[model samples]
Target: MTDTPGWASPGTAPSNEEREPGASGPTEPADRPGHTPPAPQPGAQPPGPGVKWSKEQPPPGQWSAPTGAPSPQQTPPPPPPGPGWTGQPPGGYGGGYGGPPAGYGGYGAPGGPGAWGGGWGGPPPAAKPGVIPLRPLGVGEILDGAVSTMRTHWRTVLGISLTVALLTEISLVLLQGFVLNDALAQVRVGNRAANPDEVFRALPDMMIGAGIIAVVTTIAVVIATALLTTITSRAVLGRTVSLGEAWRDARPQLPRLFGLILLLGLIVFGVMAGGALPGILVMAVGGDVVAGAGLLVLGLLAASVVTTWLVIRFCLSTPALMLERQSVVKALSRSAKLVRGSWWRTFGIMLLTGLIVRIVQVLIAIPFAVIGAAVSGDGITDLLGTGGGHTGWAYLIIQGIGALIGSALTLPISAGVTVLLYIDQRIRREALDLELARAAGVQASGAGAPGPVPGS
Candidate 1:
């Protein structure tokens, strides 16, 4: 095989066989017939005159070197010129015969570490400027980003979560301690009555109280989610935002965000109601009872499926609304667009997150609840014997405290996951990581930034 400039083959002596036509080196080996080796240098010193010549001499060309020249063991001259070669280094001018092409040392080019766009190894590691790397995220990565956001920006994240949790828990405690207590007392008294009307009449008061509590809690969650979404977005840019700053950024979109959430709830409720309507009407008209019951069951099942699908489809509406400053309708559309082909993946991630949140909430709340029940009532005996029928001030307060703490800790995780999931979806579909990289001011090639977004 022929040796090329700067890329000589291992263990092979340099040969003059393929040298350029007018090159100075001899084309044939000295052993070849009629091949004459170069004569001794004219200036070379002869052997000492007094020295006697040995009768036995080796072959003339064997193991020979010119008098003043370097042997193969010493530093070698530059490789001989070949076709299109200037005898320069292997990867310079005309590179080695099979070397990488020009511009191969670039970021994602063939010859560099990112050869074949990472086909030789793996794709270049994505840029990570903050809580998450700028690329499509795995489920674990999404969860970690949420936890990391809370860790990196604890002040803002905890502030929002704690404030919302406190307000919601306090309202619940007061309602349960005062109004709900009276309502429950009346219900218990009416339970002694044989009259069904009396028992039914006492139920609305408790239901109304529970409904008010739910509304308060929902509002609190909405506010927290809005603020936390903004904070997560900034965290992705490697920027810290104060609670007040997050509030200001989120304030303008609050009304629309509330509307978006309300609309989604209504959509699910409407679908469920519509599904049950046909069966309700059938029973109301005194049709075949068995058939009516079956239809009701089927309708309800269908409604459940539809509701779940819609929920996942619009799960990203919150982030879209807050970050894009979009109207309620537009945000829903955006979520639908992002979630179009990723329904199952989105559902799985959301379902897993929900399970994690629920588990954490239960784990944190259970101990406090046990303590509250034991302290408020006549201890564990009263709770276990009466099936937890008693509700007292101590129980409510203790339980509320547990709820407050649990909410404070879990709120950021849930909110962060949602926002990061939205961003991940966008990165997959819209190449959003490039924009994020630019917005974060990271120095990477081909990175871009969206135009100034409102509330940013």
Candidate 2:
């Protein structure tokens, strides 16, 4: 019972006079540019010459009686469909009820179906549940977040790093005092003897023992770094994870993380090696001259510059490798890529983090050092069993404590930033906010039913 307008009705076509308001209508077919007038339908009424009609005319079902306008009860053409209309065929627009647009069967609509059925462009993706919105973190915010994470999870972060560091330091202490010192003592004693060849004989044994210790320390450092990275990341995100969980997550990344660390170490060593050469040459030349000093300084400066460049280039790769589950080389390459256009910003963040951590370390160490010094009769000598001098066990113990304290305070911050940087990069590169929302137990759009965070 609905009215459909005719193609030739006045409502559809403009009147002839109105079409050519101030000019004559086209007389020749060629005169009209691209427009073609519709041909008359078979048996349809043709316009009489010189006849004209006004613009106003009611649509179908709206005819007026002999001499007046139509009744007001006639409905105007339904206003052009609003913006929400998808322009589907009849019965496709909200099941003909004219409520919301078609296909909207979700909650709160009239009783067409269950509340949650059919996609209604469901609630604008709920703020990723449980994930603290990653507000653009400034240096201060980063520092504060790190501090807070450490304060909250110090037991785990500090405990793990402390245990590892302690084991490392103990091993180092023992190797240096017992193994290396005994070997040196043997060499010294041999030198005192008549046989000069004994020194050479002792050297190989010393070298082998040193090599074993070095390999062990290297392995320990690799393991420790992986653990630290995992712990730091979890802490920074304010997520609780067990030590075993962290270790397991970190284990796979050990090789690449260690490689990155080794790469950094080599860069620093290379710089120092390069710098040492000129200094050594100057010393060999016995130069008190200004040019010799200048050459030595220049070499040192060049080495420092190279070292700084290397540091900045690879600064974020370790965490990137760990968190991204990338190969060492790939992580390094990706990190270099990320840093290509933002080296200075990366450097500044690193420098700021380093400066703050170092200051804290110094503050923590100073009191211990002072206490150790004050307690010993002759400046912490008796404390170490080296009578009345600073060369004894006491100094070692105090230094060890200082190192431990510093590590405890600074380790989390350094680890946290590195991991956060990896996350930040991922967020920037990928729309990782969606992933994070899912991780935080939020129902991300485009994902199916709201579910608990995976792996939780």
Candidate 3:
């Protein structure tokens, strides 16, 4: 067999038989006469490459051509090139047929990290400045996160809130029954001849009851806040921690949490006491008229300013304490630090959230109040003691129930905002956005690798 210049040997089937070796020899071209038979134009198989044809077939009209090749066909005239074309003639196109079109790498075109890095191929967009790069959180988003947490760990949020609510109601009821009832009954019966003596005698019981309620309620609140905070943090981070797990994480911080509550109560009490002190002194000096008028103006102003400052400073301390696992003092310091430059903004957000929550609480309370009044066999007027029909204790009880309902509904929203505020501060201070994104199960580049070894 004749060998083709580039064809494989005939031992195995050639990639292209048209380029295979001929039967005669390796030296001569396959087209040489007497080496290989000419392929049939109609139905005959063409001889493989390297096989010499008996006679080379001439082109249809190519005798004048040097190698008897076919002459180019002349057909319909071509259209003139458009604006972007460049070639030998307007009709002859070249150069633009292959590769990416012009302006491919420009800003608007599809290339690396196109606007927000959201196009076909590239790394993700850089985070925006000032804004926390967390998943977008609206009221609905926050509510959804809370609901998801509840759904996953219903026993935790519900169990804790319900338990606290029940205990609170029972304690309040018991206070109304045993403690307040005895004191009020004595007052009603005029047992002590002198009002001052009765007041002094009853003060200890009142103070003891108040202290018990405060401590118990504060403990409940601290537990609730910690559980809710940890659960919410896990939820916000898209992690699935159980209520038991959250509670366990929170239990260790109970003392600190209670300290935070105590600190808040003290701040509130101090402000209120300071505001009231001037009135007390004025009364002691000038009696009722001047004292009342002076206290009305000065007390309110002082209270407002102090209350605003306290709220701004301590608004997020509980969540900060819980999440950061800090002592009460540390949590207060952390809160002060976070709120340092943004006190007004933080206050405004808190005020807005409070106003909205208060409105919701009012709405929820109204229906419950109405229901409680109806259940107590008192119309609205009777319930208010304005119809000359005093439902008395019944009215107070109904009102308390209404307050309870309102508190229940407001609790979650208030707790949610507090938790969110802590997260917002972290995101601002630390690069917590990246850590949160990672926690939310977003697979970041090089994220799986261990962090740098110490001292390395």
Candidate 4:
């Protein structure tokens, strides 16, 4: 048996201590199907002279002892029977062969015959010192662990998420208010023929503005992911952390993390570009324009498939890098290794998490968008469909506040799921729960639930 319940390492054989009695032990005569013909009755008769008993089948008087009972060496011979003794064994019922010993209760009683019939209960539950139990986790448990981390460490989680969200929202607000406002206003919603030149002129500025916003948002997400990953790891150990502590722990990984994100972005860009390169070449050569368009669409579809596979394969890279202090390349390799056999499962969990986060954002954003449009004298339809003609400071500020709230609530959950998924994968593949158990000071039997580590 393992020291801790359900923490057995892969490939180890179960010990005899974990097996039922007599399962592999030597068998006795009484345990065989047929009876050994009752011990030759006391001196009633003997075989005639020259008659021989077979050696293969021992005589009745020499029958072997019964299984699961005291050996002959342990107990003295029974006393001779008295008048009307009815041939009962010395002790009472169950003193002799197959019957259970007296005082062992009958069918329904504890330690009775029914107990030996094998309904061993399910394996003992794994130790749970913190948000997740120390074993391979289910999808629900993973989600619950993420939420529990956020709820349990709301202070640090909220602080980090809100700070990043506000900074990102502020940058967006400024860019839209100052730079994108005029650029976007130049393009007429209708009459494309008349406003062709205006559209062409505004396209460059609009692209630049959008690119800047993406960069700023990426940076904010990186910081939030790093800090939240650290906090989530600590939370799994039943320990609390502060924003300052989390920042200090995650700061060193930030530069490498940024590099990793950039590397992935470039990879995706290369894939998409490569996918469309052939079609573009066909179009550039001025041959088969329709065919080229068709090829381009097909190429883009293939590229989307490849891109999705790669993203899920490397989704755990962030947590691996942050927690293992691994290089960007090593972290990528680690994620691929962990996700090797479970790609679909990982994809499903991540997709579910994304859907939930998007839902939350929409639920929170629609109200603010509606109110902002109402206050700015723009219709809600315009706000939802087109950006509307006006996005005044009041509208931007209100929208920013709503975004901040949504992000603060959702960022930790996203980061937590990533971190916890990494953990769950390791637990399944590497038997990591044993190490976690030790770190958390869980007892061998998993009954001595210790408090969180003192310095954690």
Candidate 5:
């Protein structure tokens, strides 16, 4: 009260008896819980540049230091304008980030990045640099990442895919042109009945040609995976990488990767052959046709189930081998570990991604297939090499072009989804998001690295 304050006037303010006891005094502000007002000093001049301001103690649980130190309970104000600071004020308009005020823990530092992916703290922040956001991904995000990577790194992604596809198409064309047409033409020319004996007689030649195709395709798969793996690695960090750079980083792992693919293929072949052996034996003995057919169906079904399980379990091996640079056995073990608890989810993603890839392949291939068929005026069987009519050289050339284009477009999507699945699972199980953030030059609250993911 102006009227009651110890006869209040300019210099002579009211005493506590005449005014509220905790009210601000004329010369100083009120005291806060861990702070004390500094006693008046001679010629202090309000503590200017280069001089330490007098005691303004932080409350308990707060770390105290000079400039650049963080405050305990709030966003620390930015330090004095230094070189390259652009002369903005601290923590305000144009003073903070030119982009979003992302706390290293993700924007606004809200509760530690939502447990690396378990607890839904809303959607994760979109940290750019990579096509995908650097968080555990949703189904949409996974697909988006794949598409975005293709768009952003079209030169590399398309280049690698198309190159591999071209080579693969060439091999296929040669096989169809030179071997398949000739082999089947022989059967047709002889006018032989399509019995088991006849088919078996030609089987050895078929196997030889098939073996050559397998080797070529396997090499193509390895090349594509290696290039895509390196690209994805850089993509995760939101960095752009070149074709040369990807090759440099991935080349060393190719031999081992090829070996791993062959080894796995053999293991799978062995399992399938072993499982289906009883049915094979029944058919070989020429028993009752219905009984043999039923046994064959059962054996095939059982083998299919086993193959699916094994495929899902080791699906991550390619990424593990390339990215982790591990040996074949270690990569298999690593993939198994990543796939252990999340089998169903991984299976679903795999199945869906594969279905999508196949659909795209069909869509792309259909027109070419139609053109090839139309040009030849041959039946469906001739288009696909049945009845030994032999697809003409012209059909081979036309179909090869279509297959090349389809392979070019589809390879990136298929490879990307697989690699992203591996990354997603690691983020879910091993807190890989934090490592990714650091690698991408993002971070968490000045903390060295993010810890384990919750529920991991």
Candidate 6:
């Protein structure tokens, strides 16, 4: 007779540690038909493909060892219903020699048992004692983590994002309020000039100013994305960090992260270019107009598909690069593996998040835009150039304030959800809960990460 570990289930024979002093393990019950087996221990490897996790048969010969010892040749029957396994509806009492009830299969297993019997080997994962419960997360939980992080570590999360947003917005406002205003004035004057050539000639400076704005804003976003990603990774483990600490951790990866974004951008551009090239060449060389258009559409469709795949494929790479400290290429490969079975789920969540963020931006911007127009109260003159291409300074400031607030809120949610999603994927695939618990200084124990408790 072998000694059972404390975490072993009812069907498994109990060791000395689990029983009362001088008590033997519970006896096996007589034959039963439909009893399900107990779940695997927290550390058990998931079953191999096509192999359902079931209680081991009592070695074909000996059954449970009775406290009173059975005589030599005769075998004891299966264990009796006891405290933890009293013929319970689903307490996972083991059945006779055969495995789990007929046709039992785990979730994702082929011909899996009915919904209630998802055939999961164990109880649903217990809650890991951390910022995020260590397990694959539902959509609501991922979103909750983002909000919870911000609420819990406002000093760090909001501080970093706020500083970034404020400085960027200030520079942007000044650039548009002063320099771009001058550039636009020339364009307005050129518009009224008798010679239309003047309008074309005056456009370059305005274009240059717009380009500068785009470049500066992009740099701000890239830096913020890196810093926020670092903060979220720690926050998920319930650790509070400072701005300096966050920056120190994130700074090393910023250069590579920036390059990764640029590389992704290039890939997307290449896809679009490749898709449209056929049509562009046909039109340039005087080929059939209809055929060129058709090819262009077809090429663009192909490009869109490829571009989206790349985007989803690498979606988890940023967090991988930061949290795992993996190189960019390795992170990308890691993300690809985690995402292999859940492409559509990831894609749908991402699309929904994008749509939601966009809607929020528009909602916030629209009211501010209306307020700006109302305050400025002179669009007609500006349009007619009676005001020298001027909309009131107040108008610009108000609009910028709205944009600033919108960005501050949106940036954290976007970055946090992305990182949490990455962590969730890893928990499901690589058993990241074990790593996260260790990081958070929580001991891994019999309990696994459980579903969110209502109202908790």
385, model 4: CA deviation in Å? 2.0
Model 5, range 1-456, lDDT digits (tens) per residue? Answer: 233311222323323444444333232333335758778699776533222323443233232222223335444444534322333343342314332343232223324433121223433344555776666677777877888888889999998999899989998898878887655654554445566556544544564576567657656765686689888777877788999998888889878988888887787777766665776677678776556556756776798799889989998899999998899999999999999989998898878877897788888878887787778656565555455566777677888898888778877887888889899889778878778877778753322223432222
Residue by residue across 96-176, what tens digits does model 4's lDDT show?
344454443322333444433222332345688889888777788888999999889888888889988988888888888
Candidates in descending lDDT order: 4, 1, 5, 6, 2, 3
Estimate, for each residue in 68-96, the C-alpha lDDT of model 6 and write its tens digit.
Answer: 34455544444433322223233232332
Cα error of candidate 4 at position 402, Å: 1.4
Clashes in candidate 6: how many? Answer: 13
Alpha-carbon lDDT of model 5: 0.69
Error of 3 at 78 (Å): 38
Q: Which stretches of candidate 4 lie over 4 Å from their true place?
A: 1-119, 175-218, 276-298, 386-393, 444-456
lDDT of each: 0.71, 0.57, 0.57, 0.71, 0.69, 0.67
* TM-score against native, each model: 0.65, 0.56, 0.59, 0.68, 0.64, 0.60
lDDT digits (tens) for residues 1-456 of candidate 1: 233433333323323344444433223344556868667788985333222324453333332222233445544444434322222343342232333445443223344453333333323466788888787778988999999999999988898899989988998888887777655655554234335444334444665686577668656766777899988998888888998899889989978977876887688768877887776677669786656656766887899899899988988988899988889999999999999999998999888988998799889988998998788754653234333244667877888888999989988888898899899899878889888888988854423332222211
Against the hidden true structure, what lDDT does model 1 obtain? 0.71
**lDDT per residue, candidate 3, 1-456, as tens digits?**
423322222332212233324333222254544768445698766444443443453333222322122235423324434322222332222212221344333222244343221233433433322122363334444444454556665666676676666667666756665556555443433234537545545544554566566656555555566668877777665555665787789889887776777787787667756776666566556566454546745785788698779768876778878877778888888888888887876776667667976797678767766776776655665444344333445655766676666655555555666677677666556656678766666643432222321211
Task: Supply the TM-score for candidate 1.
Answer: 0.65
Arranged by TM-score, best first:
4, 1, 5, 6, 3, 2
- C-alpha displacement of 26 in model 6, angstroms? 33
Q: After superposition, how far is residue 381 of candidate 2 from its true place, in Å?
A: 10
Best candidate, TM-score: 4
Model 5 alpha-carbon drift over 4 Å, by segment: 1-126, 178-219, 377-388, 444-456
What is candidate 2's lDDT per residue for 1-456, written digit by digit as tens? Answer: 123321112233234443444433222233345967778799986543333433443443333331233246643324324422333434233343224655554223644454334343432333423222342334565556566666776777777768876776677656665566545555542134424345444544565576556555444544554576766555534478777888788777776677776776666766756774775576457664445446656776888788778767876777677777888778778788867766786788778888987898788877776676676445743333334212335545675688676766676677666655655555555656567665566545533233332211
Model 4 lDDT, residue 332, Cα? 96
